[model samples]
Target chain A: MLEIKNLHVKLEDEDKQILKGVDLTVPAGEVHAIMGPNGSGKSTLSYVLSGRDGYAVTAGEAALDGQSLLEMEPEQRAAAGLFLAFQYPVEIPGVGNMTFLRTAVNAQRKARGEEELSAAEFLKLIRQKAATLKIDSEMLKRAVNVGFSGGEKKRNEILQMAMLEPSMCILDETDSGLDVDAMRLVADGVNALRRPDRSFLVITHYQRLLDHIRPDVVHIMADGRIVRSGGPELALEVEQNGYGDLLAEVG
Target chain B: MADTAVLVAQVPTVEGKVRPGQAALAAHLDALDLPRGGFSRAARQDAAQRLEAMGLPGARDEYWRYTDPAPFNAARPEPLEFAADDATLFTAIDRLHLVFVDGRFDAAASDPLTAEGVEIESLAAADAGDDHWASGLYGRLEAAGQVPVKRPFAALNTLAAADGLLIRVTGQVARPVHITYRRSALDADVHLHHVVKLEEGAELTLLESGVLGARSNVVIEADLARGARLHHLSAKRAKDPKLGLGHIFARVGAEALFKSFTLSVNGAMMRNEAVIDIAGDDAVAHIAAAVLGDGNIGRFHHDDTVFVIHGAERCESRQVFKKVLKNGAEGIFQGKILVKPGAQKTDGYQISQGLLLDEGSQFLAKPELEIYADDVKCSHGSTTGALDETALFYLRSRGVPRERAIVLLVLSFLADALDEIEDTRLREDILGRLEDWLTERAGNPGKA
Candidate 1:
């Protein structure tokens, strides 16, 4: 469902290159976890796929469902079924979470040439999805992520993911600021949406998050490239001994 | 009191001290004629003397440096085509309607000047006889407001007003008095003065809207007694580019509450000044403004100048001003909060912000605070910036279009300024008008 070939990305303002040359692919109905240490370009990969600014994709290509992602705008990428869960969700003051979600839902539907959901339908849908994530109505009515706790922010991101229901989702360090309970809740929310036609690329720094989600494939990424690919046990191995030993052995 | 008589003498004298601004002001004032205008003679003459002493604003003056006073000082304004539309605001709510056309009171178009618990009369029709209530308030607050700053335009307006409204509230008025202005003549220059007086334990709500004319100079003076409450809401809508200069002079007594807000949309040049003085203990005053200017449409330049003074203990004042400018439009805000001696526990907060939609737009703000009392909390902040790029990208990444995201963000940025409105319905009405302005120019993000 997602493909990247020799993807090279660099900061637009500096001479530093982040993603030198990376190759990866996730088939349909599969859940893949990318465990990387600091400066390994895991977050950059997600941002590049999501069409965020401040980065120049110097070489190679990334695609979602056979559609090129680099050429599309961020909103276009979303309509093309590409979702990126931010490491730190932005705090947008004065914009209610419910309004933001509704706007996004209708926008995607309009882009796909589908009928827009009515107000009542949207309220019902969001209420059901939000209840599962423990996001009450008061939280939904407040400003988007403003004054929200770290756990609440992550859960809000998960709620957005559920609302959008994209074909391919990238969770970029979603567990960084979450506690064990919050991680479990986020995992449960993600697990509930695991469908046969959908795919997930979970980017994390530790094996704790993968313990709950139970990825089908685990990839150890170091220095802008994936060094090893194996079953979920690869994460357990990294947790036992850090990436230093694995990188030294590979070297 | 700067020797208003000696400054402009009918006959020249070798010992006369000629102020620099008065010569050009006298020359400008020469082309116009004065009249009685059906107002209290003493009040009109007092205002006229004040204007003569201070003179009109000049570009080189310190206070007028940011905003050009040429449009306001011109003897004759360039005529504009009158905008003939029936979309006068405040029609959805029940209100006592009073209409004015080109600064002239339109009796045929206005509702009867009779409401329970309130006394409303046309200033031009009311006889300025002895013991008249208006005689005490015609320009009293205005004269007091001019001590620290010279509002020559307001002084000129008081003397040249063609018509006005005199409203006296003794009890809680059940309905708001809505004053709407309409311009029929293209070259019409309108001058209007309104006064509202609230007695002790009284309450009132005033709603003002519409276009005055090609050029308009207006002033409204409000006096609130102890335990009185006043809510003043006004929205200026001018389809045709015009010149508008307005001022609100208020005297808030002890334990009184005064709140005023204005929403300015389009104009070639517009300036609104508010001067509020709280003399009684435990009084509360808040003045806010939201301006949207698009120079590409008609050379937009909007200015809001506010002065709030606290003279009694435990008084609180707040000033919130926000402006959104695009297409080379310029927005200016000059706000000051002054706490006098013995005014302990004075809580003052002021925030002035500008959101420029593009590089061509500009926002200039000067926020000032002066404190004399030892125990007080006074804080002021000013900011000018483009929309939050990260927030915009976040919204876009969630599948919302870039333009739609921008509109939403703009509305959110303006929501803070609108929060000062206590009435939910009036706030929503103003918010809806602001949203329409943003949506009309949604595609013009002025960025890549």
Candidate 2:
């Protein structure tokens, strides 16, 4: 349901290219994993797809459900069923989590000409979703991610994805700082949210996360380009042999 | 007349007779048929004399350097005349009320509080007693000795003040007193001299809400006694297309606690000045203020000044000021904390922060700390910045529109100061008004 063809992006007001001719596609009912070393443009790809400012798309197009995602604003893209779980979720000091989530959900609903949910209805829906994710009700009353722990912040990202229920999800480094237990919980939350019509592109540095959320396809990214594509066995190979061998093979 | 004469005698002669402009102001004061020896008469005269000697505050004055009062000179204000029908402005708040129209007390509208040992009388009636604190404390904490007066509007308030409120809590009264100042017509000026004396171990809460017309000026002076605690909240709402000016002076005694909260929104031209003196040792003072201005509307200006005297050791003082300027509006803050030589172990902290929503919006912050004591912990900081782009993006990506996200950010920026207020009703009331102001701006762009 999501496609990025020959994508080339550079930092605004600078000549340094961050994403060079990157091609990726995730069709309906399939999960893809993009594993890469440091500075391999994984986070840049997510930011560019999510329409963050300061990242200029010099070439190529990113489409979601056959609609041009690059032309939409950040809010519009989210409404169009595109979700990016940020590596570093921002702390919105005064905006409570419930208020922020409700605003987001209702904005997307209104954009699609659907009736808005009342406060009671929203509370009921969010409670059910949060229960499956193991998020406490008290955390919903606080300012969004103001003082959340690393595991809690990542779990919050999954909670948001479950609430938004996007058709296309991009998990950026979801397992980077998580402990074994947190990683397991987060992967479980993601697995519960998966559906036949939804697709996910899980980006990470290690193969430990691959053991929990088994991907149908795995791709190796380096120097702003995807150089290798294979089955999930490639992830196991990379864990044993490391990226040093893959770098030489790609060269 | 005797009250005026006593005021003139107490007036320092360092600068001799009042200047021409001050003479005009004094003439305006002479026009008011105020009762003799009222709360503010002598203080008004003394302040007028000081303003005359100091001359009008100009850009050269360090405090008045950033904000120029020249725009207020377009319209000349006449002596305030009491209006019988000006009581409509008090409808928004429901409390035991005391109404002051055109700087004179209105007994018909005020509900007398007659708790045992607690006296809530008019300044005119209170002055008849031997223990009147008005004459003893008015204008005692003004910074005219150092900073001097350069603003013409403040000079006018000094010259025009008349009747006020005197609240005396004897043997520890528990209930709160709400003082409401309502401005009716344009070009109208009112001055209030409020004296709150808490006997040893007495506690009181005073909420001051000022509602002004297009062109209005108000000045208030207050005092607290030993071992007594007082919490004061002042909210100013001015929507007139003309000028609006406000000034406040207060003093606290030894071992006493004083807290103040100020909120100002929608004024063609507005200024709220607070000068506080911690006269007694072991006394504590806390001051917090929040101001929001729309750059597209009439110019909105705020000048807040604080003075702390460490008369006794181990005194504590804290000040926090936050301002939000949207559109092309301007926000200004000036705060100073002083620790005396013998006042060792004094703890003082001051912080001023401003958020500019648009490029045309402007904010100027000046925070200063002056210490003479060697064993003191004092620090001051000032910051002016725009909304965080990353925070904004995070909210927008979650489906919140840009405008709603901005409002949330602005409210978060001010929550720190608002949380410091102790009165739940007053805090909620201020928050409601802030939401109303934000809603109005959000609904109608360029119509501040």
Candidate 3:
């Protein structure tokens, strides 16, 4: 269960406000999609929820399973079962993908006061997860996101989501630069990890990705606020009409 | 010009002005008795006079701008009381060990000096001989390295080194030769010089570890014949407050390969200078160093000065230096590539990067390219900055703690320099050690 109550946020270095009194809720086992035009504060909502720096939360509260998230660090948020799949996966040279995954997995486990996974166990689990996503062993051995194509970066993010197994997954514009086949592959990867206790906040501009993943609900956001909420058909309506009619109707 | 001065035993005055610090050099030399009447007797005599005329470095010198040379030129080594059990870095491999304690060879602690396809003789033994095979080679390359720059410490070592190894490899040596330097007493100042020669079609890997002493002036002069290959790797992580000066001079022949990499973790002051000359076509030479320093522990300052001369056609050279400094530590790099007239088809590259964790830490670099040839490719770059904030956020968002993420980023930054190591096992070993160092200090920014 993820809940946002009248969330307000502004840029740390500027006077611009990115999120304004947005309210939303996602029950467990539900997939919700946010469809909006450009400059709709879609990414800011995700970043603020994930505890990323450079955002000052002026008001409201965000919580995962009744635990406040704004007070925790990014790593603490990750350990608390909140995962944000960055739209732009950072290219970190010198650190291999496999190493990053293992370290992340072990770190979360340790934070939760669980026994850390051994090297062999972590390697086996990552190999199994990567196999389903068609990630080759060579890709896992290279530096994280270095020399990776657009689709590869997205797939790598899915691999990370799978490894983390978070309770609330936020895909921030994950389908922007992805092609059809690549989007389907990524959707399948995300769909495979869906469980009864897991919830997803898939943020995207198009409805094709929702067609594959099959979101249960959709929300229309504009000017840093969500104006309307509806079922899956709402995504198709916005996709066909291009958010013009929706924004005007709400106005 | 300095080499010629050694041959003539006279100061090669330039522009009718003598080198600075000669008076200071004379006063500094008055405190010690130089090694005399050895197999390298004439060479030592000439070097002493040459060093007198050239003088030791000072704080105001151009090349010594980033690093103060007063420590190296001090009449005696400052007292460094810190000590630990010195260990060899290559214990995972089957290699011959030559241990030196306080500038003297410890025969009981060292392996036998006999190896197949290789001949090793201590400087003590070589000095006893009136005529020796190393007579022409010893101190020759060091003298030659002094032409475009002044390396007074190396000259001082050539004149007064008490004991070192004289190695000659005629065939491929399967095992590496590891030289471990250790000091068992305080206030130990050592002047040790080593001479290494590789004949045609020969190969050898040399390894050195540990700090020489509280104040150590060390030199390794290498002469590589045609088709020869030499791999030199050193680790200086005494974790103590001390000063060390090291020089590596090599003369490479046609189709030869010379690669040197040094990993310096923590030291009060360490200066490494490597000068290489490509005497024949189709040779390749690479010099790189990965340094980490924390001034909070004591005082940390590391400098790497390199000069690569391409005198032949189709020769290649590379210089990679990466440093991570925190708590007011400083790192310096002065690297240059000289493409002589008609030295066409030269490929040279140089890059230096520093990741400073705090406002007090700094990295200074001087990368130079002096090329007279038209058909050549030379690139040089230097960068210094803090850890990438985005990368840090990415790692932290993935559940890695803030401290551990910093260490991981540092390992990533040094990956390019570590890649210069061709041996996988050795590289991994060094990587593991680099991690330990970072996790110990760099991981905890304010912790000493």
Candidate 4:
């Protein structure tokens, strides 16, 4: 469902290369996890795929379902079924959470030439989805992520993912700041949305989150390249020791 | 030579050399052909004298530094004969309609001026007697407001008003009085002066909307007695090359409440000045304005100058102003809160903000607080900033289009000022108008 070929990204203002000659692919109906030490360009990889500003794609191609994602605008990418669950959700002071979700949902639908959801329909759907994530109407009514706890913001992002129902989801360190209970809830939310056609690229430094979501494949990323790929047990091998042994062996 | 010197000596001496625009105002006043002996001849003569002495504001004047008053003093534009389509802004509730065309009352289009506990009289039909309630108020507040500063345009309006109304409310008014000013003539220059007096415990709401005229000068003087309340809202939407100048002078009595809000959009040049006096103890007053101006270079300008005076103990005053400028549009906000020596326990808050859509746009704000009272709490803030890039990115990443995301952020920037509107329905109406304006601009490239 997702493909990246020789992806090389550099900071726009500086001559610093963050992603260097990386290749990865996530097939449909499969979950892929990328685990690496700090400064391995894990977050940069996720950002490059999502089309964020301040990063120049020097030489590479990123495609989703045979369509060139790099050529599309950010919103177009979202409409094309690319969802990024941000590690730190932005705090929008005046845009209410509910209003934000509804606008996003309708905007994507409109971009795809689909009939917009009515307000009542949106409210009902959002309420049912929010209930499972433990988000109350009060949080939904407040400004988007303003004064929200770490867990609430993550859950809200997941709720958006559920509502949009993207085909390719990128979870960028979604478990970094979450407690055990919050992580369990988030994992449950993601697990529930797992389907035959949906795929997830889980990027993290720890293997704890993968325990709940259960990735089908694991790749050890180092020096802006995928160093190795193996089954789920590869995660356990690193967890038992550390990336020090792997980094030494790769060098 | 001796005779000429004597004649020149007889002429009044101004503070400085008369500006070209100021010298032309006398000629313009002659063309207006003001009538005599309507409400207060003395008030008219005093105002005319003051206008001549003060002259028109010049670029050098401190108060007029940011805003050029030349257009307002220039020759009036030829009338716009475009008939107003049925675009009603205040659809929240039914209201008593009053129509003015080219600054003249349109009796055929207006509803009959009749309501329980309210006596409304047109300035043309007002009793000329000195004992009338309006006589004491015709231009009294304007004169009183000029103590700390001078407003020559307000004085001009008072001196040469062609038509307006006098309203007296002694009880609760269920429906708001909606005044719609229409422009039917291309060469119309309108000067209207209105007076409103609310008796003790009375309540009233005044709603104003429309394009007043090609060149218009309007003054509204309201006096609220003890425990009385007045709500005033005006929505001014004028296109390019038209000029609108308005002034409001209100006196809030003991335990009285005075709240006023204005929404301005798409004017070549527009200035709304509000002067409020909290005279009685425990009185409350709030004045807010939201202005949107988008046009070519030097074509759009909006100025909101507000002054609130606290004269009694424990009085409260708030001034909130927000402006959205795009495409070289210019916005100016000048507000002051004054607490008198004996007016202790006064609570005053002032905030002025501007959101410039591009580098070409400009915003200038001067927020002032003068407190002679020792035991008062007063704060003021002013800010000018571009849209939050992070917020914009967040919205866009969530699938909202770039244009819609900008609109949402702009609306959020204006949310605090809109909350000052006491009525939710009316606030929503204003919000809807803003949204429509933004949506239209969104479709036009290079506007955002």
Which candidate number maximizes DockQ? 3
List TM-score per model, in order: 0.94, 0.87, 0.95, 0.92
RMSD of 2: 6.5
Rank all candidate structures by their DockQ, best first, as comma-separated numbers: 3, 1, 2, 4
User: Residue by residue across B88-142, what tens digits does model 4's lDDT show?
Assistant: 7875578888999889888899989998879998886673555567888888999
* Candidate 2, A71-182: lDDT as tens digits: 8888889888889998888888766899889989998899888999999999999999999888999989888998899999999999999999899999999997899999
Q: Summarize candidate 2's per-residue lDDT along B344-389 as a digit string, tens digits.
A: 8899988888888888877787777778889999988888999999
Residue B316, candidate 4: alpha-carbon lDDT = 89
Model 3: DockQ against the native?
A: 0.87
Where's the lowest-lDDT run of ten residues in candidate 3 chain B? B11-20
lDDT for each candidate structure: 0.88, 0.75, 0.90, 0.87
Cα-lDDT of candidate 4: 0.87
What ranking of all candidate models by TM-score puts the best one first?
3, 1, 4, 2
lDDT of 3 by residue, B323-368 (tens): 9998899999999999999999999999999999899999999999
Residue range with the least summed lDDT across 10 consecutive positions in model 1 chain B: B439-448
lDDT of 4 by residue, A90-157 (tens): 88776788888999999999999999999999999999998988889999999989898899889999
Give the winner by lDDT.
3
What is the lDDT ranking, best to worst? 3, 1, 4, 2
Off by over 4 Å in 3: B1-20, B85-88, B442-448
Where does candidate 4 clash, by residue pair?
B78-B186, B79-B185, B79-B186, B79-B187, B80-B186
